[model samples]
Target: AVTRELALFKVACTVEQRAEILQIAEVFRSKTIDITEETITVEATGTSEKMDALEKMLANFDLREMVRTGKVVMARGTQIT
Candidate 1:
């Protein structure tokens, strides 16, 4: 099996395009966490490759802020084989 890691992102878009921004986020399986008059923050989780693609896509938008948490893995008391 191909091991996949979870990466989270906080994408903030210009207030004027809050709804439109969601369309882009949805392509990468992201959800909104916070919204304001000037910005909207969304969270996305996926593999490194997926995250990279999503980041590239977001480049097309006007981002007020952006933050990404690198890949993370969890062990359930057992090692992978």
Candidate 2:
């Protein structure tokens, strides 16, 4: 089976910290969906573990909010198991 999850992280950031935050998001293969003077929102999709790791990294900054979806699973073969 294959499993995946989606997460959105909102982190408070300063102008100087914006580049660093973007770098972390890049490393996680996440997309920066929204950005404001005070916050940056990142959208990530991967395994649960990956989401956890990304969250941990983002926590270094001022993590404002987080939203995560339940795991989505699908069978690999044509038949459902």
Candidate 3:
């Protein structure tokens, strides 16, 4: 599975504009999900074209933000013989 995630955009966006920006984000929800735990996650799935668009949108929304730690992951599956 492929996922796209946006982080720290809450801190990136000025507090005054966060609400309006979030409303705008609703239109771009696409196949992604945005989470709001201690660490945030903004992930989605779709074609490269769609993913690119969503990524650009997030970048624009969080221009000053950059991935701090990058990505960390683990595989999940059952072996079949």
| TM-scores of all candidate predictions against the true structure | 0.65, 0.96, 0.42
State the lDDT at 21 in candidate 1. 77
Best first by lDDT, ranked: 2, 1, 3
lDDT of 2 by residue, 1-81 (tens): 999999999999999999999999999999999999999999999999999999999999999999999799998989695
TM-score of 3: 0.42
Tens digits of lDDT, candidate 1, 2-73: 435544444456656666778877777787777677666777776778767877776677554556665566
- Give one clash count per candidate, in the order shown: 0, 0, 1
C-alpha RMSD for every candidate: 3.5, 0.9, 6.9
Clashing residue pairs in candidate 2 are: none
Distance from true location, Cα of 37 in model 1, Å: 1.2
lDDT of model 3 at residue 44?
42
Best by lDDT: 2
Cα displacement (Å) at residue 32, model 2: 0.4
Give the per-residue Cα lDDT of candidate 2 at 30: 97
- What is the Å distance of residue 68 in model 3 from its true position? 15
lDDT of 1 at 41: 71
- The CA-based lDDT of model 2 is what? 0.97
Order of models, best TM-score first: 2, 1, 3
Error of 2 at 67 (Å): 0.7
